[model samples]
Target: MGNWKLEVGRMAMYMSFPVVLFHYFNQPTYFEEWVTKTKRNIFPPENPQDKEAIQQLIKDMRTKQIQQFEGE
Candidate 1:
């Protein structure tokens, strides 16, 4: 069997291995681009045409609703 020092060293290694990995991997610079790219892929930038179309659709719905209430 090993001495106390050897046992302590083993325990320290077990505990610190994950801590060291977390410290290095949690840095934003390491994965910020990756996260941003994934976000862009999931939700691409909105286009002007898409915005205009959405506004027009909303306006049409509102107008139709007003007309229905007025006609009733």
Candidate 2:
């Protein structure tokens, strides 16, 4: 009876370990909120140079898309 109880305890310990590890490893450590906030704050800049840089970036992206569409 003691051995059976010990075996049950060990089995429970083993089963619960994986569950604890799964929760510990799979739990969300989120970053998207702060990253999005940082991105939003950077744009529509007060500096003229920064605004021009953003405009050029958009133009370049549009040009790439147009080239891709023509290629296809």
Candidate 3:
């Protein structure tokens, strides 16, 4: 019975971990900062042409995000 209880407690803790992680990582400031950093890391602009493309992509993403939140 003690072993069963320990197993159940471990299972419960493991189940709750994803919920805690989701809550922590989904906070807007953290999520946005992570996204910005990831984008910069993955798509560093090289030249003027690349910079222009990046700017347009940023503009489009922001506009879409605004519309999505406004709709919500």
| Top TM-score prediction, candidate number | 1
Stretches of candidate 2 off by over 4 Å are 30-72
lDDT of each: 0.99, 0.86, 0.92
Candidate 3 ranges with C-alpha deviation above 4 Å: 33-72
Quickly count the clashes in candidate 3: 0
Residue 4, candidate 2: alpha-carbon lDDT = 88
Question: For model 3, what is the alpha-carbon lDDT of residue 13?
Answer: 99
Tens-place lDDT per residue, model 1, 1-72, is 999999999999999999999999999999999999999999999999999999999999999999999999
Candidate structures ordered by lDDT, highest first: 1, 3, 2
User: Which candidate wins on lDDT?
Assistant: 1
Model 2: per-residue lDDT, tens digit, 1-72? 578889999999999999998888665566567667788888644888888999999999999999999999
Collision count of model 2: 0
| lDDT, candidate 2, at 54 | 100
Q: What's the true lDDT of residue 4 in model 3?
A: 88
Instruction: Report the alpha-carbon TM-score of model 3 versus the true structure.
Output: 0.40
Candidate 3 lDDT over residue span 1-72, tens digit each: 579889999999999999999999788986797889999999886898888999999999999999999999
